[model samples]
Target: MEREHFSRQFDAELNDIREKLLEMGGKVELMIANALLALVERNTELAVQTIAFDHEINRLEMEIDEKCLEVLARRQPAARDLRFITLALKIVTDLERIGDQCANIAKRVKELNLEPALKPYIDLPRMAQAASTMVKEALDAFVRGDENLAIKVCQDDQVVDDLNEQIQRELLTFMMSDPSAITRAMRINYISKCLERIADHATNVAEMVIFMVKGKDIRHTIA
Candidate 1:
């Protein structure tokens, strides 16, 4: 009876970790969306709000890390359970870093807001959307234990990479042609790089999900 009770309690603890992780993931996704929207609309207020929310993400990372540690100490989980706990730790770090990238983009949005419009902003929003979706799908893959969904996330990362490259090339042309546009173009380039980094972090999470579910480490290998 005691062992059974302990088993249920341990399961509940694991569930708690998962719940917290999902919460953090959701916040990071919103931060990315809000930051990009602020950039497109030149809404400095929304950018400020998004930057402020990153503090919450940082707090959640610490909270989840502590919870994982407690579970490790008390439950002494092994095998799949062990993998889940460790991956939870890893995922939160990735999520937190994603939040940091969002904050960086938000800061760039503020700077760009001061300058005149730079082009039509045609490809930047699309790239941000793709990156945001990758983040959402990666978290979904984690919760569903869907290896295929995780693999798809990995595959989709290249789309974002390509968009980023395209944006950089266009911005380079602007800088090459109009010397005065250098300031605004460079800021836009930084924002594009931030969005690209966010996608990279999402890919990291997806790779970790593959490890958690299949016990296979596919980090350095092509997915």
Candidate 2:
């Protein structure tokens, strides 16, 4: 009876950790969305709020890490359980970096808010949407153990990459055509780069998810 009770408690603890990780990922996804929304609507207030949200993400990271560590020390989980705990640690790092990227985007949005928008933000919103989707799907895949979805996330990164290159080229043309637009164009380019980095982080999460599910290291092996 004592062993059974202990097993149940251990399972509950694992679930709690998983839940906390999901919470962190959700905040990151929201951060990406809010950052882009601020850029599109020219809402500096929203950008500031998005930047502030990062503190919560940081707190969650530490909280989740502590939980995972406690489980490791107390339970001495092995096999899949060990993988889940270790991967959880690595995933929180990626998620936290994604939050940082969103904050970076928010900061750039504030700076760009001071100037007239360089263009109508044609591909940027699309890029942000794609990157944001990657983040959401990556987290979902992780929690759900959906290997196919994780693979799809890995495949989807190319779309973000292409959009980034296209944005850079267009901005370059803007800089070449009008010296006055250079500053705004460069800021916009930086945001594009941030989104790209976020997508990269999402890909990292997806890759780790693949490893968690199949016990295989697919990093740098996919595409």
Query: Native-vs-model 2 lDDT?
Result: 0.92
**Model 1 agreement with the true structure over 1-223: per-residue lDDT tens digits:** 9999999999999999989998998999899989999998999999999999999999999999999999999899999999989988989999999999999999999999998897777798999999999999999999888899999999999999999999999999999999999999999999999989999999998999988888988888875
Name every residue pair that clashes in candidate 1: none
How accurate locally, in lDDT, is each candidate? Answer: 0.93, 0.92
Model 2 lDDT at residue 157: 97
* Residue lDDT tens for model 2, 96-124: 99999999999999999998877787799
lDDT: worst 10-residue window of model 2: 115-124
Q: Distance from true position, residue 88, model 1, in Å? A: 0.7
Residue 106, model 1: Cα distance from true site in angstroms: 0.6
Candidate 2, residue 159: the lDDT equals 99
